[model samples]
Target: MAGTNLQTPILQVDHLSMKFGGLVAIGDLSFTAPRGEITALIGPNGAGKTTVFNCITGFYKPTEGMITMTRASGEKFLLERMPDFQITAKAKVARTFQNIRLFSGMTVLENLLVAQHNALMRASGFTVLGLLGLGGYKDASRASIEKAVYWLEKADLMDRADDPAGDLSYGAQRRLEIARAMCTGPELLCLDEPAAGLNPKESLALNELLLGIRRDSGTSILLIEHDMAVVMEISDHVVVLEYGRKISDGSPASVRSDPKVIAAYLGVDDEEVGDVLVEVGDTSVIEELDGVAPVAQGPAETSSMFEGPIADTVEEAGGETIVPASPAASKAAQVEAETAAKSPVEPKGPAQ
Candidate 1:
C-alpha cells in the first residue's frame, strides 16, 4: 500500500446533512480531516456531533451531501453510497464507540481475531476451498495470529491476551477495544468519546496509545471527545460543532481562544464558570472560574466533562465555592465538575 499523504485530507464531509422524522440532526456541515493527523470534533450533547460521525461512517445514509474518503492507495470512495460493512471492508475506515464495544466474555486476543474475520474468511475461501484442502489457509491463520499479537503488544496488553476482556481494568479494556479496531488495518480511525468515564491516569494511558497509533501506525484519527485534556493533548487539528454546524476549525491553540468556542461552552451552563480558564487566551482568568450560577432551565444535562470518580467533596471558603485541584486531586475534580456541568466544552489546549 502507498503511504498516506500528510498534507492531503484523508476524509472530507461536504455539505452533509442528516434528518429524522422532520427533525434535522445535522445541517450542511462541511470539514476535511487531513491524513495522518488527529482531528477532534467537539460540541455540546445535542449539537449533532455524533450524527455527523454516523453520516461519515455510513451508519446513516445521510439526508444529503457527500462523504469523500481518499485512501492511502489513492483510491477515492464515496462513503455516502456505501453501507457500513462496505465502508469498513473496502474504504478501510474503522471506529470505536463512546462505550467500549467488546465481547466481554471473549478473551482479549479473540476480540482482535474477530476483527480479522473478513480477512480470515477470505483466506479460507469461505470455507469452500478450505474444505477442498487449500494450502494458504494455514499461513493465513498464522498471519492473523501474528497480527493479533502485534496489536496486543502495541496496547501493552500482551500479558492479558488470554484473559477475558471483561477481566481487564477499565483503562485496559479501552486499550483492548482500540487494539481490536486497529487490527482491522484501517487507514482512518474514528474514536467517539474514548476518554469518557476514565480516571486521569487511565486518560493518560489512552492518550499515549492514540499518539502511538498516529505516530507509529500512520493512521489518521477523527475523535469526538468532551475531555478537553485528551482532545487538546493529542489532536493536531480541532473542529468545533454547534447544532450540527461547523463553528470553528483551527489549530488547538486558536480554537481554544476563540470567543465563539468560549460562548458555545458558556451556552451549556452560563452560570458555571469552571472552564472559563480555557475560555480565554489568558490564564489569569482562572480566578473567575468559581461557583455555578443557577440557570432558569437548571443545569443542562450533558455527557461527561471534568468528570471522573466522585471520591471527594467540593470545599467552601467564606460561603463561596472553591474549585480545587489542590493536594486532594480527587476533590478538585469533583469541584471542577460541580462548577462545570457534565459536558463542559472547553479546550485545555495541550497544556497541563
Candidate 2:
C-alpha cells in the first residue's frame, strides 16, 4: 500500500448533499480533515452531523457532491463512488459509530484481531495454508497478535485483554471501539460522538488517546462530538452545522465565540435573545429579534405572558399601578413569570 500524502488533506468533502425524499438531511456541506490533525464536527441536535459521517463512510449515498480521499502518493479516491467496504479496504478509512458496534460475545483481544481479518485471509491464501499452519500464515498471525497488544496497551485495556467485550464498562467499551478501528491501520479515522456518555475523567482520557493517535500514528481524525470540553481542548479545527447547513468553521476558540454558534446552542427564549445577540456583537439582529414581541391580543394572550391577576391586584391596591423601568424589562419580567409557572414542580408524595 502507498503511504498517505502529508501535504494535502486526508479527506475533502465538497458540496455534499444528502436528501431523503423531500427532507434534506445535509445540504451543500464542505470541509476538510487535514493530515495529522483532529478536526471536530459540532452542532446542536438534528444538525446532520451524523448524516455527514454516514455519507463519508458510505452508509448513505449522498444525493449530490463529491467526497475525495487523497493519499500520500497523491492518489485520489472518489469515496462517494466506492462501496463502503472498498472505502475501508482500498481507501484506508475506518470509522466508529455513535453507538458501540462490537462483537460483545468475543474476548477483547479477539475483537481487535477481527479487524485484521482481510490481511490474515490473504496471508493464509483463503485459510488453506492456515489450516496446515504453513507458509507466511504463522508470521501474519504473530504480527496480528502483536498489533492487537499494541492497541490494547494504548487504550488501557491490557488488563481486560482476555475478558469478554460485553463485560467491560461503558467507557472501556468506547475505548475498545476506537482501538479496534486503529488496528485496521487507517490513514483517516472517522469517529462519531466518541465522547458521548463519558464522565469528566473518561472524557479527559479519550482526549489523550486521540492526541496520541495523531502525534504517534499520524492518523488524521474527523470526529462528531457534542462535548465542548473535548472539542475545545484537542481539536485543531472545528466545523459547525445547523439545519443541515454549515454555520461556522474555524479554530475551537473562534467557533466557541461565534455569535451564530452561540445562538444555535443557546436555544434562547425570545426575551433573552436580544441580550445574547448584544453580547455576541450582533447588534444589527437585536432589533429584528426583539421585533417579534408578543402583542396583548386578548385575556388569554395576556395571561399566557403574565402570571397572577394583574387587574385584581390593581383594583385591590386602590388603582395604583407599578410600572417597569422599560419595555425590555417588562417583557423580561413577563417571560420570567411565565417560565416559572410552566416549570414542573417535584411531587411531594410517593406514587399512588
Candidate 3:
C-alpha cells in the first residue's frame, strides 16, 4: 500500500482526543493543514471547536493521539509534548482568540513587542552582561520594535500604534490581535473567530490582510470562523464539525454541497433528508442564476442566517447558540434571498 505523504504537514492532527470528565470535547479527530494555505475548522456552537484549539495550543494535553507541526526550516515538533511556550518557540504556531485578547491598557505597539519577549530575552543571553551594557540587548530591543512596526503597518494599525489598544474600534482591535500573533514569527497561525464582530468593510479588510499574509509570508493558517463571506472568500479548504466529530472536510465547494454537511448545520435528521435536498436544490438553482452563488453555493455558507425551526433545533440539540448575522451578514443574506427568488428550480427526484 502506498503510504500517505508526510513530507510534513504544517499541522497534522491524528486521532486527537480530548475529554473533560464525562464530556468528550474532541473524539478521535484527524486532519492535515497544508503549508501556505488557509484551512478553516467550522461548526455550530459547542461542537468542541475551541476545545480542539486549546489542545493544539497547549492549553490542554490530549487524552490520546498526536499533533505534529513542521517548521519552515525543517524542524518537526510534537505539539502535545511541548508546553505552550515551546509550542510557540519550537513549533512556531501562533494564535488569536475568539474574543480579542489584546493588552487593553497597553499601547498598540507595546502589545506587539511583548509577543517577541522570548527572542529579546535570548538575545540578551539571560546574563548580567546585558545589565552591564556589554550585551547587545539595546540593539535587539530596537530590532524587536522594528518588527512590531512592520506588522503594525501590515495590519494598517501604524497610525494608531501609540493609542491604547482598548481605544481602537472593534475592527481595529481584531486586526491588532492578528498583528500581535504575527509578531511571534509563527509558521502556522491559528485564528478563532477573528471576524466575530465587525462591519462589512472591516471584514473585507481582514480578508485582504489574510490574503496578504499568505501571499507575502508563506504562512499557513488554521481558522475557526462563522462569517460565511470571510470563509468562502479566503479559505482554500474547509472542515465542518458537529457534536465533537468530523462531519465534512474538503474544498469550500465540495463541503457546501455535501448533504451531511447541510443536515449537520441545519440540525435536521436523516429522515428529513428529502425535504432538505428539495429545498436546497430549489434555492441553490435560483441562487446560482441570480448571481448570488455565494449563498446558494453551500449549506454551512448560508445557515448562519437561518432562524427558523431548524435553527432552533440545532441550538437545543447542539447546546450552542447560533451565531447571529452581523450587519454585513444581513446584506449577504439579502443577496442570497434575491438569488433564490430569481433562479429556476428543478423537480425533486430520489437521491442519486
Clashing pairs in 2: 4-72, 5-71, 5-72
Cα displacement (Å) at residue 331, model 1: 30
Sort the candidates on TM-score, descending order: 2, 1, 3
- Compared with the true structure, all predictions reach lDDT values of 0.78, 0.80, 0.77
lDDT of 3 at 7: 50
Candidate 3 colliding pairs: 286-343
* Deviation of model 2 at 345, angstroms: 41
| lDDT string, candidate 2, 1-352, tens digits | 6765466888999999887653557777888888888999998787789999898888899999999999766789999999999999989999999889999999999999999999899999999999999889999999999999999999999999999999998999999999999999998999999999999999988998999999999899999998888988999999998657777888988988887677666356775664564455432222221223333322322211121122211111243434332222222333333444456898799868
Give the residue spans of candidate 1 off by over 4 A.
Answer: 1-6, 128-133, 266-352
What's each prediction's TM-score?
0.75, 0.78, 0.74
Deviation of model 1 at 55, angstroms: 0.6
Best by TM-score: 2
- Model 3 ranges off by over 4 Å: 1-7, 125-132, 266-274, 277-352
* 1-352 per-residue lDDT for model 3 (tens digits): 3423445578889998786643456777899998889999998897878988999999999999999887777667899999998898778899999878889999999999999988777777875556766678889889999999999999999999999999999999999999999998888999999999889999999998999999999889999988877888899999887656676789999987887566546346755654654544423312221222333343433233222111111222244533332222222333334445446798899999
lDDT of 1 by residue, 61-138 (tens): 999999999998878999999989999999999998888889999999999999998878888899986677686778
Which RMSD does model 2 reach against the true structure? 12.0
TM-score of 3: 0.74
Clashes of 2: 3
Per-prediction tally of clashes: 2, 3, 1
